[model samples]
Each structure stands twice: as structure tokens, then as C-alpha cells.
Target: MAEASANIGVNFPPFLNSSSPTFLPSRTLKPEFPLTSKLKPNTWRTKPLNLTAFAPSSRLTSAAFTQTDDGKFQPRIEADNSRTGRVFFLDVNPLCYQGSKPSLRNFGRWVSIFFEEVSHSDPVIAVFDGEGGSEHRRLLLPSYKAHRIKFTRPPSSKRFTKGNFRTSYQVIRDALRSCNVPVVRVEGHEADDVIATLVEQVLQRGVRVVVASPDKDFKQLISEDIQLVMPLPELNRWSFYTLRHYLAQYNCDPCSDLSLRCIMGDEVDGVPGIQHVAPGFGRKTALKLLKKHGSLENLLSAAAIRTVGKPYAQDALTKYAEYLRTNYKVLALRRDVDVQFQDEWLVERDRRNDSTILSKFVENNDRNLLVQPSKQV
Candidate 1:
């Protein structure tokens, strides 16, 4: 549809031709909230990004390259005084609350610790998806995230009402501002896009980044110098994610995460998909089809080939081709999303107890707190 996989010339058996029996998906799990809006198919207007390279700085502290017990790389926090500085692109939603369902008011202390744990002495640019975050995606597919807006967040305790999550979010924001951590909320974009756009900005300066969020969508941004930190409320810890770790867990390269999501669709996002395929079946089927044909275009092309027996992938690749293409446009990330890259955004400011950075941010009237002693600060 919108994008094709690199492997398009896959060899197919001679038996494949136009007269084959097309397979059809038999069932799809009923959505919690049924789609009310009509699904319209259209090519996206936003331009796709042609990313040249993502080579972040090679400089590091002695412990920057530490590995887990399994020998996978772990992102390390660095000293501002270190040769290479580190900044955390902390997704504000995680610090928002555990679920739309209500939770405790412990968001402040927990977020402070989380910022400290991930950013160390380095600065954290907290990002929040504005209230209309999914607006553009809805333009792509009317059904995009139709299920989420209807549900009310449940408060964990009586003291914290379901409606108080926003209040909690504000409390966390003030707490962060007081801590000298600069936070951003682009009025009409999702936090993920803001994070992506900002990641490109920092990577351009050869600075390493740690995206602190549990959202799996950020996996597409992983690389040698960029890593993901997931909040683990159950264990009261955080899980680190890397490209190597993603491959080890999903059996496919991290680059294919978007493609896989396009084929199967995501219930969380309310993206429509093939019916009859069981929950988790989409991933297995998509992985198989991708492995065999290399890309979605090829997989769809191969679906057109006539086979002696019925093919199970008929509906999604053949009949549903238009749907897949439309979803890809919505699923793909836009790195060129016209966000202003402020110079101070790339500067990692310190958050010492003296409130020096906080005072600097307010006094300078710069959303991005300047960190340098001799110049800006």
C-alpha cells in the first residue's frame, strides 16, 4: 500500500497463478466498542520520511556499554560532566497513570524517582500527547482509536476520582517543572510523534537518548545509541528494551514492527483488520507471510498467484489489500512531522536540589532550561 518491504522479488512456485482458491479469514474478536464511524480509504497526504542514517555519538562513559546477565546491552545513565551527555525522552503518559482506569496519587514521588533513575544527573524532556493527540490519525482512518475516548478512567481509591487523572497529571507536571525537567505538549500530536521528532533532533547532534515509556510503538526508534525504558508497575521496576532484545523476543527485526502492525492491526488503536484470525494469530500469520514473501507488496502480489490448494491468507492479502494499504499510512511514523527543534532541547540541564535549573528555566523564560554555567544559564 503506502510502503513496500525491501524483498519484493521472492520466488514463487509454478503452480501459483490467477485461478487459485482465495482463502478468507473466518472470525475476528468482537471489539469492545464497535466502530460507529464509516471506514474510508485514502492515500495519506503527509510525506514519508527518508531517514539517511541514525549514527548517534560513539563517546561513552566506562559503564555505558554494560550488558544484562543474558549479555544484552543496557542503557546507562551518564554524568553531565561525562564526555558524552545523555538525555531521556520521557513519555508523559506513563507518568500520567497506570491505566485510564484510576490509580493512586503516588504519580508525583514515583515520577520523580523514575526521572532520577533514568536521567541520572542528565536532563529529561517530558512529553505529553495533547488532548487531541490522535486527531491526525483519525483523519487517516475514522476508526482510529474510536474505542479509547469513550471509556472513563477509573480511580484506584475513593480519594482519587476517575476524573482526577488530569489533575494528577498537572500535579506531576508542576513537580517536574520544579525539578528542572522541561516538559512539552504539542497541542495536536501524539506523544510518540513528539518523541520521534525530538529523537531525530538529538540524534542529529550525536547525543545518545533513552526513551522512557512502556509504549511498544517506540520500538521502531531503537538503535545502538537509543534505547527504551518500560515501566513495570507490577514489579516496581523498569524493563529495558533494545533492538537486540526486540529481535530476541519477537523473532523478527525491529524494522518490521510497523509492517507487522499494519498487517494484523492493533486493537488498542482501533485499527480495523482481518476477521476470523484469532487473537495473536495475526502476528504469526504476518511473520510467516513476511518471511516467505519479504514485504507486504510482495505478500499481496504472491496472494494473486494461483495455487492448487486454498490459501489461508487470501482475505487479508487479496480482498483486504485496500484496507492493509490504508492502515499502513496510519501506522507508519512520520519523522518529518514539522516540529521546531529548540537548541536548549538538546542541552541536558542538571536538576540539583538547589533548584538552580528550575530558577534558570523560569527566569530565562525558556521552556527548555539552559544548563551551561558560563553562557546561557
Candidate 2:
């Protein structure tokens, strides 16, 4: 599951995109700005940027949800404030939740564990997939993410009723809103594009950002001010996938990984790979090929060599070189897409100092909202 939880503070307007940068944050001159920055860098040659570990050391106070007129569960702001230099670009997808039809209580727990890892001063802006997830991508490839809409196994009768599944996701969104986190969406864009836009936009203001999704597409967005955070909900641990993490894990850079993706294709997104041609055209072989020939363009240009490993489809790759070009567009994240931002969305909410009451947010908020309606008769 590649999708999951993440959002920020903002008073959203009726209109989405802004003509002028009304929400742009103030910037300060920094001495450490990378000079060799390019739109697309040769990632294989570049060294990894030094980034702060994703784990938060200080013990953060947990509080029960304080509801206002609208029934949303927000943390009762009560913790000593400390500065977190990064603003989190959180993605709100259910891929992180376990089992069939995950409940709102599980969502609340996700928020709790995730928030506890960052300082209260670090702002978060959670983005959700809009009406049709990635319409543009679908126009490119009709099968993009179409497979994710339906679960492989039937929904659990004990877990959630027929209609309750959608509601559970809604409750998660409502709970995040209750916390005053800006849960945003553009009419035609998915969270991936919105996150890509924000990651680049914030970096221009010199603020650091960390994207909280395990989607491989985000790997290309990794830079000095931006990183990726992968949550291991099962083990109750979160790992920061920086440039170093990727290099150590994949033996290649994110840009090179993108090139590899074009060759391998993603079954999750419904993109077909050239696996029919080259039996060994998986990750390792692709990386090996990428290393031998600096870029995909170079690889395709040179003579097709017999690759090592299972079912070598050397001729298959030669025949499908053109198809690889078409898949690249589908596999790559659109860094040039349009997205709107709210001013307050960029700033972190100061953690309040009034600490007294303590209760589990899920137990209190979800018992009625989730249980009474979905309980088996």
C-alpha cells in the first residue's frame, strides 16, 4: 500500500488557485543554499544532503480531542513549545491502515504516533486525493491506480458495513480538520501533484519540507530542503528515506530510480513494464544497466546487450524502446503542475501550554460515530 495519512492550518477560500502569491511566506538569505541546483540534476553523481533524523526526541504530551460546533477530534493543544525547522506535507490516504475497512480509531492512532515524532512548532498540511485520483495520469494511461479502488479480498463483515468504508475515511478527514490542519485538494489534481508543487514552492521560501508518503514517485522530489518519511505502522516505527537511505537501499539515486521505473513499470499504478521482454529487467538489473549507461537515453542509444539474471529478453527490450518513452511520462511525477496554497497552511500551530485532561481520542470520538451505526445486529 503506497497511500496513507498527513495536512496543516489554514482558512480555505472558495476559490483554489491564487493569481498573486498571497500565502507566500517571508524568506531570509541563507549561506548554505546549494549553488549547482538544476531543474533535473544528475542524481547518480550528486552526494546526499545531510538531513535531520525524522524521530522526535522530546516527550510530547498527549491530549484528548476538543470538539467545537463541528464534530471533529483535535488534540487539546497542551505541550511545551519547541521549534521544528521543517513543515510536513502530509498525504491522507488509507494505504497505511491495516486489514479490511480500517476504522477511524486506527486513523486517530496514526495521527498520534506521527505527530509525536515531530515538534509542535513544525507545521503540517495534509492533502487528500480529489474527486478522481490523478485525472491527468488517467488521460495518459487509462489504468493508472484504477486497481487500488477495489480491495483484493471482500470487505470484512465484522470490521465495516457496506457504506461505512467511505465514511471511515471521511471521519479521518474530519478528525484532521478538527485539529485545524489544512486538509486541501485541487479540483483536478491528486495528492502527489499537490505535494510536488508544495515541496518546490516551500523550498523557494527557504523552508524545509518532508513528504510523508512511501510512493516511489516522490523519490525524484528529494532535495536539500525536501525528504521522504515512510511509516511502519505494523512495527510502530517511521523511517526517514533520505538520499542516503535511497543510495544505501537501492545502490542508485532517486533520479536514476525514476529512469529505472520507466523500464520496470509500476503494477500499483497500472503501468505495464517491459518485463515480457527482459526477464531480469527488475530493480537490480535496471540499476546495473543504469550504472553502465549513465542515463536511459544513453542506454537506449547504445547497442542492446544481453543482461545477466533470469529470462534475459535482450531482443524484447530493443523492440520496446519506444514504449519506454511513453511509460516515462506516466511514471514521472509532474513537478510543473498547478496547485494553490493558503498562507496559514505554511505556518505551524504553536502547541498550547494548558495541560490537564487526558483521554484517548479514538475511544471518545469514534464509539458513536463508528460503532453504533456499524455494529452487527
Candidate 3:
């Protein structure tokens, strides 16, 4: 994937200046959607976003951050403590496969709704999966995400072909650029790593962050300062996952999430679980071990002295120490990727609202119009 250029010649908001040390205070706006609600499993309401819901008066207000002379971002302080500035990191890869059929219409509509719901004052940055995004992971374990290719077959419908997927991605990229949302795709790097790096950078600045994607891999990054908003296609709504939610779901700290995945393995990514190699070892067993040992490394240390879990569990750990260690490397997200946060990537809410680019794209590529088959290119 190619790197997206910054929006040139656009004026930065006052708080966004590199030399400023404070963010402008803005009144807190209640989220239109529910932040925490219990719902039945596999039950999602699949309603399209109401475009008319975006009221003209709801424009984004304050700038995201101000930079100091030393090139470091200074955290914004609200005199009244109303709302801290927020920046959204949008992972664009999962959006491509959101609906039953993949098309530019599906992707574009979601993108529009996301920008519409986000506060105009906060910045939004889009991250795309770069070319060979999975190569590095594959090198760690050749089976990483290899199942996707192994199970790949020709799509039943031409509309769902790889070509259509690429077209949809391109159209969305163009639309985001036109609206002044920074679109980033670092070559040879996965968006997961890129987003992880960006999250780390922003956290150091003391700014709040929201990552928009349905990928569970991001769970490891959850914290008080950073939250995740996942799309619920079946419900046609977005769900928020915060540190509380992560704790409730995992019964463990976010830092231990990587170790949990390393032990349990990820079927979606084609990583084999300890169960595959050690019979009768499953999620419960993995969780128990993790809760006690805290991490795979610690568990291995105990196993070295034959003090970890039951005899069989200890035997498995000692026998497959190399395998478990490799899994950790495969599952851990990189925080040192060579991407930096740029002020130019901040969403210019006023310009975005005035632009007709996204609306036009949605109108032209409406889902109804994409049902018909297209000529093979």
C-alpha cells in the first residue's frame, strides 16, 4: 500500500499548532449511541445510519492538541473539566468486509456515518493495511493467517471478487482524502502495528483516543485513556469497549491479553492452540494458567521448575516451550513502527461538512445500484 500524503496548505486549528502547549476546552457532548449495554449474543440490529441525523449545528469545535517548541505535543487542559480532546484512529481493513456483499457503497456509507457521528472538533485519522501487511507475521510463523489463503476460493458473485474489494478500498481512500481525513498505509506494515504505534504516541501526549474497528486483536491496547468502538452490523450500531468492558469480558488485565492469546491461539489467524498439541487443554485451562502465572514467560519459568499447573500442563509447557514462545512473538503487536502523528491528518470538520465529495460518492454507489453484475475487467 502507498503512503497517503498530508493535506497541504490547510490551516491548522489554534490548539493544533506545534508550538502551543494547551488544547482548547470544549463542552462535553453525550454520545448519541449507548456506551455500555448488555446485549444477547449474536444479536445485532443491522440498520443503516440515518444520514439526516447529522444536524448542522453539531459541527466539531476544539482542536486536538498543541505542540511545544521541542516538537512534543502538550496535553490539553479543560478549565471546567468538561471534555478532553479526542483523536480517532480508524482501521479501514475490517470495514471492507462489513456487509454481506463488499462494494464501495457499503464501505463509503460507513465512512460517512463514522465522520458524521464523531465530534467535529476531534481529529480522525484513517489507517489502511499496507502491501504485504501480514508478511512479517508470516515470517514468524508461516501459518499466521495462512488459513485465509488456504480456504480462499472464487467468489460466487462477481461483485464480491478481489477486484471489487480493491475498488471499494480505493474509492473510500479518495473520499476520505477529499474530506481532509488523513489516510495512512505504510508499505510492508500491517494497520494493526501502525495503529498500535499511533496509540502509544498519542497516549504520551495525554490525549484521549478511540480506535474504530471490529478486530479483537485491538483488545490488548485497551486502557483508561484509549477506547475502542466496534461496528455492530447486525444491529447497525457501534459498541464501545473500554477498560471496564475489557476486564468484564476477559477477567484479566489488558496487558495479559497477549499471553492469553498466545496460549489459547487464534483460529481466525490460523495460529494453533495449545489444545492442538496438548489434548484437553482449552480456554479454561489457558485462563487458569494465565491468571496464576500472569504471562507465558512467567508460566514457562514456573514450568522449568515443574511448578506450573497440573503435571500434564507442566509437561506440555516444558515440551513445547519453543512453540509457545513463538506464538507470543506472532501475536504481540509492535509499538515501534516508523509512523508518526501529523497535525495535517487532523480532520477539518468545517471543510469536511461543506464538501460534497462523500455524499456524492454514496449517492452514485448506492447498494441498490451495485446488485447487478459488472463486466469482467
Best by lDDT: 3
Tell me each candidate's RMSD, in Å, in order: 19.8, 15.8, 13.4
User: lDDT: which is higher, 2 or 3?
Assistant: 3
Candidate 1 C-alpha error for residue 190, in Å? 0.8
| Order of the predicted models by TM-score, top scorer first | 3, 2, 1
- The global Cα lDDT (0 to 1) of model 3 is 0.62
| TM-score per candidate, chains pooled | 0.62, 0.64, 0.71
Q: What value does the lDDT take at residue 181 in candidate 1?
A: 64
**Candidate 3 Cα errors over 4 Å, as ranges:** 6-83, 99-101, 147-168, 346-348, 351-355, 367-377
Residue-level lDDT of model 3, residues 1-377, one tens digit each, is 33665453321111111111221122233333432221112222333432111111111111322335754322334332212346778888667553434455666666666665533445678898776778878888988876442101234464565554434456667777776677888878888999999887775554567888988898887654666777777756555666545555665645678888988899888788888899877788887787666678988888898677777787889999999999988888888888888744433344444237877887877763333322211
The runs of at least 3 residues in candidate 1 whose Cα sits more than 4 Å from the true structure, single-residue gaps closed, are: 1-84, 102-106, 149-170, 276-281, 301-310, 354-377
Candidate 3, poorest ten consecutive residues by summed lDDT: 51-60
Local error of candidate 3 at 277, Å? 0.8
Among these predictions, the greatest TM-score belongs to 3
Better of 1 and 2 by TM-score: 2
Could you tally the backbone clashes for each prediction? 12, 8, 11
**Which lDDT values do the candidates have, in the order given?**
0.53, 0.53, 0.62
